[model samples]
Target: MRGFRPGLVPTLVVAVLVPLMVCLGFWQLSRGEYKRVLMQQYAERRVAPPMDSTELAQTTDPAFRVVELQGHFDVEHSILLDNRQHDGQVGVELLQPFLDRATGAWLLVNRGWLPWPDRRTPPVFSTPEQPVSVQAWVYVAPGATFQLHADPVAAPWPRLVTAIEPDKLWAELGRSGFSYELRQQGGPGAYRTDWPVVSMGPEKHLGYAVQWFAMAAALFGLFLYLGWHNAGRPHGKHHESNQHV
Candidate 1:
């Protein structure tokens, strides 16, 4: 207060911005921690032995859990998830209903991504008519599902959708099915089955947090410097007047 006089405008700007930047920095740290925990859970569940369809149906926390499936794909009502990209090429992920023979429960299985070079023609794919065994993992989205456009109410077979809702699909097909989607690991009916656990890693979040914090520090430093600089101007003028007298 003695030799520091911050202008009202600068004080107001710092008051509004500094707290906001600090809050954003902490929020990013929280997000980074959350992503770390999620990745750990995924690693643990993925390594465990694959369970059967009955066990899978009874599972409460089924994120990233492996499951063994013995079923035939219902190719007639396939769903092509739009806007999927792989290796810098535009593509769609193929999802189909598979009936588990052991438990008589239907499941929506994501086979894999397929490139659609020409929009005029549908992506080519085939289904195994006979019973086939495969291994897949339960895929629970980290956040709310996204859709560029809502699926039409009366969408026909081989539907093109931006999001996949297993419950809605099962209801439309009039079948009692598992509510979660199962992403195929590798088997007879899989194509490009490799999937990443998370889109953005924890390190990226940490980096963003650092940037926010740095910006807050820089702004606060500028505020302090301006306060001191303005205060010194009046003190220097008073010293000169006293010397003249």
Candidate 2:
């Protein structure tokens, strides 16, 4: 009870901050668990046999599945993902629209990363004219980290963008397509497609949780120290005086 009474100001500050710190710690813990499950799913799905466009469309979540698609590249409308790097060189990633041979639906395919041979002009890329079967892993749209500017309005062919969103691309192209990107597996139209296994792993989340929890503990300790120090009690209260003068 004595420690609980940390005066009005200290009580209000502790009430607001201590709970906030504790909530953040638990939130990180939940994030760590979610990451653990996601990592497991990615590991298992990446090795499975590649799926066709129809099968891929039916699947609920297609983040990292290796898929096999028979399609012809829409070479004329190819776009470049700006500000990409390859082997310590500044460049861009080529993203081409694909016309699926089976379903006749359009899908965006990441060809690969290319160095900026000339920053002033766009590099010329050779695209296959014939129908080709491509094996690639499914990757969703660019996340918040990739975004530097607002999604541009209707732009010319071979657009340059800071972020890639399937819906936005479809809106610009005026066609329907799969909502995910295909990181070219092999064959023609390939670039540095190798990506990190996990964006943020469980270990990193756990470390963040530890930091939040530590802050909560430190806040609790400070509150206790303030209360104990502020309580009016003499160093030798018992021996000082038993009767008033």
Candidate 3:
């Protein structure tokens, strides 16, 4: 304390910045933990035996639960979710209404991604006319629903949109259906079904946490060094006297 004196401005800056950096570090850690738990749940539910529509309707938490679907796709009212990228190629995901014959329940199914290189023409995709058996998993978005741009209210059949709202789609179509979207697994009615559970993994969050914490430590260290260095400097009067002598 004798030879270390931090200026008021520096102390104030450190007071604000250090705590902010530390809080950010902890926030990143929490995010990493959350992603880890989410991925674990996804992995567990994905491998379990596929459930029927009746069984699926009863389940409360069905994030990645696989379901066996005996349904035929409605090709007329197709939804193209825009701004989807695969292997550095721009594309859109095709979603169609499927009527499950067994349970008489309709559900929105994401068939998969298709390359839409030219905007002048619609994305090319096909639908199965006959009732087919397919396996798919319930896809629940992790956080709040995001949409880059709102879908037009009166968009025609084969609607092109930035987001998917199955409930709204069902309401518009005047069909009683499952609210959640079912992502089709590889089969007759699937295209590029490879989906990443999380965009940024836990490791990325952990790395960001380390960076924030390291920056905080470096700032505090610099604060200490500056305090000591400033305190050790000679006063103006002492320096003037010494120069004159």
RMSD of each: 2.4, 3.7, 1.7
CA lDDT, every model vs. true structure: 0.90, 0.79, 0.91
Which pairs of residues collide in model 3?
A: none
For candidate 2, the TM-score is 0.82
TM-score of each: 0.91, 0.82, 0.93
Q: Give per-residue CA lDDT, model 1, range 5-28, as digits (tens).
A: 989999999999999999999999
Each prediction's number of clashing residue pairs: 0, 1, 0
TM-score order of candidates, top first: 3, 1, 2
The CA lDDT at 69 in model 3 is 91
Off by over 4 Å in 1: 235-245
lDDT of 2 by residue, 100-137 (tens): 88888888898888778787887767888888998888
Sort all candidates by lDDT, best to worst.
3, 1, 2
* Model 3, runs deviating above 4 Å: none
Per-residue CA lDDT of model 3 for 1-245, tens digit only, reads: 76888898999999999999999999999999999999999999998989988898888998999999997999999999888999999999999999998889899999999899999998888888788999999999877658665778978989988877889988988999998999999898689989899888999999999999999999999999999999999889999999999
Q: Could you tell me which 10 consecutive residues in candidate 2 have the lowest summed lDDT?
A: 140-149
